[model samples]
Target: MKKENNLDKITRKEAISKMGKYAALTAIGTFVVLNPLKAAQSSTPPDDTGGNPFD
Candidate 1:
């Protein structure tokens, strides 16, 4: 039978740190991937021509 190794044992602090790091990395990755596309999208312009979809 194989025994558990010391390295496999994780302490409370290590677990918390790992979770925080993972959350930060995930946030950064999402921002890095989506921010550019969001910035490139054009905002709604004012309709000076006075035309409405209902009209």
Candidate 2:
């Protein structure tokens, strides 16, 4: 009687797929870390007096 472990078995297709996914994730992470987006800053907001001009 012989016992085989399925967890130790990996196909070539699966390995390539996993490698590609990891590569894509790494690239995206690198890009985000290197060049981050900055939020727009406003110096001052418009004033609202709430007064009617016809009054």
Candidate 3:
């Protein structure tokens, strides 16, 4: 059997750091993509009457 080398193994800290970076990037990307839609939806004035606007 071949012995495993320490240099080839990933440490817990390194794994956690990589995961954190991916999470942060995903969050930023999601926000960027959704922010425009959110703004557009909010720009429309709300109807005071209790009726569906789409009707």
Candidate 4:
């Protein structure tokens, strides 16, 4: 039989943190894969900051 090592153990908080990281990556990957065109578009919003100064 093999011996268990304490160093191999992870706390619940650490596990949750790791899971969160993976979840975020998965979500981003899914978004990019499903919406490649959208993802490639510019993040900046259009110049719709209200009525024109001249108007």
Top of the candidates by TM-score: 3
Tens-digit lDDT string for candidate 4 (4-30): 899989999999999999999999999
Clashing pairs in 4: none
User: Estimated TM-score per prediction?
Assistant: 0.61, 0.55, 0.66, 0.58
The deviation in Å at residue 33 for candidate 2 is 0.2
Q: Which candidate number would show the highest lDDT if scored against the true structure? A: 3
Candidate 2: segments with Cα more than 4 A from true spot = 37-55
RMSD of each: 6.0, 7.1, 5.3, 9.3
lDDT of each: 0.89, 0.81, 0.94, 0.88
* Full candidate order by lDDT, most accurate first: 3, 1, 4, 2
| Deviating ranges (above 4 Å) for candidate 4 | 1-3, 37-55
Q: How many backbone clashes does candidate 2 have?
A: 0
- Model 3, global lDDT: 0.94
Model 1 quality (TM-score): 0.61
Model 3: per-residue Cα lDDT over 1-55, one tens digit each: 9988889889899999999999999999999999999999889786699888799
User: What does candidate 2's lDDT look like per residue over 1-55, in tens digits?
Assistant: 9999999999999999999999999999988876643222434556978998689
